[model samples]
Target: MRCEEIRELLVAHADGELDDVERERVDSHLANCPACRRERAAFESTGNLLSLLGPVPGAGRSISARVMATVRGEDPWCGHIRRELTAFVDGELTEAEARPVREHLATCAACAAESRALERTGDALRAWKLPSMRIGLARLFAPPRARGRLLRFAAALAAACLLLAVGIAFFVSESGTATPPPGLLRAMEMLDPATLEILDQDPGLLEIVRDLELLESVTDEEVALLTLNGSGG
Candidate 1:
């Protein structure tokens, strides 16, 4: 059998719910496939965990009632009934409610996947640990008026940092000369004619600007070639 077909049977096989023929097929496949064996082992281990929780109180009647309701042609997919799946996983459902959920999960692949995902999430949350924290320690406890001023100062600093970061990013995209500081590039963009003339006195600065203009005029195809060839132009 294909891996997927074998997988669909793994859970049922682990639960001993498969018919003899299907069980033999799964057993043959598992004997040869280490991955499927691992999967079966994992499911069996999770089943053991579930067994430890024992039976949920008051779940039998609820499961029977839900099954009866479903038999009466009530929509099992309705929101209220569907929401019970979560409660069912949490052991909040009585046996009656839990039974239908378990049967539904066994038959419906999507609901079964969701129930496993919920179970994994619950396991993770249960295993998670929070580090101990000291209360009100390492705090300045600034007065409200002072805190307001601090917030305004932080806002202004953040704005300034944002602008500086943007300027640097634009400079990189523009391929500003490494010889000149990024601030110099920004200054040159907004400089008066006299300031630009002074900058032009530097041969290296003038050469970079000339190359930038040539790049701006290059055709798309030429740019593609340049990119492919790693050409300076």
Candidate 2:
């Protein structure tokens, strides 16, 4: 398995959900893949720390209320309200839903206040502080437990950053310099003028900047069809 495959499986492995075959594959792959191992370790450690921190206060209250209402069978609109309110709380609402919610919040004092309260609660919740032990300001004088966790966090962060930088470098080089599929430029000529508006914004030109690769491929396909039909080849 590749690094991405191993990295994804690592979570399951850490949770002890991997079957024997999957476990063996992850072990075999991790032996040859230091980067994936590090990514796995980083995520595991992050998950550990978050679990230790416990759930966010009152994050469940809205859901709990909805569940209770459903049990009572008295609030017919409960389901709709819960789904929309949860999506709005998570900023997952589409533009259409967002407009209605915004309008509702504007005219409805209760919802407007609830929105502010929720925002304030979110800000306050982010203030969850992990206790840090501060030893005397001296090299090699810190408490062992504090020093160990600190070192682990620092190492994980450094490794993660290095991996990200390397990955970005590889992607950039591949996208910018890799040989294009033949007739790519011809396709560019055929894409709709409106579609080209976004491509035109690419300082590297539509074909040159390759970071948004999936989008680039889509544009290329559109352009290629145009180029081929136009050329009658």
Q: Which one wins on lDDT?
A: 1
Estimate the overall C-alpha local distance difference test score of candidate 1: 0.53
What is every candidate's alpha-carbon RMSD to the true fold?
A: 28.0, 30.5
lDDT of 1 at 81: 46
Q: What are the lDDT scores of the predictions, listed in order? A: 0.53, 0.49
Poorest 10 consecutive residues by lDDT, candidate 1: 129-138
Tens digits of lDDT, candidate 1, 92-165 = 99998888778777766656766775665444333322121011111212344442332222222223233433
Model 1 RMSD in Å is 28.0
Cα misplacement distance, residue 101 of candidate 2 (Å): 41
Any residue pairs clashing in model 2, and if so which? Answer: 187-223, 187-224
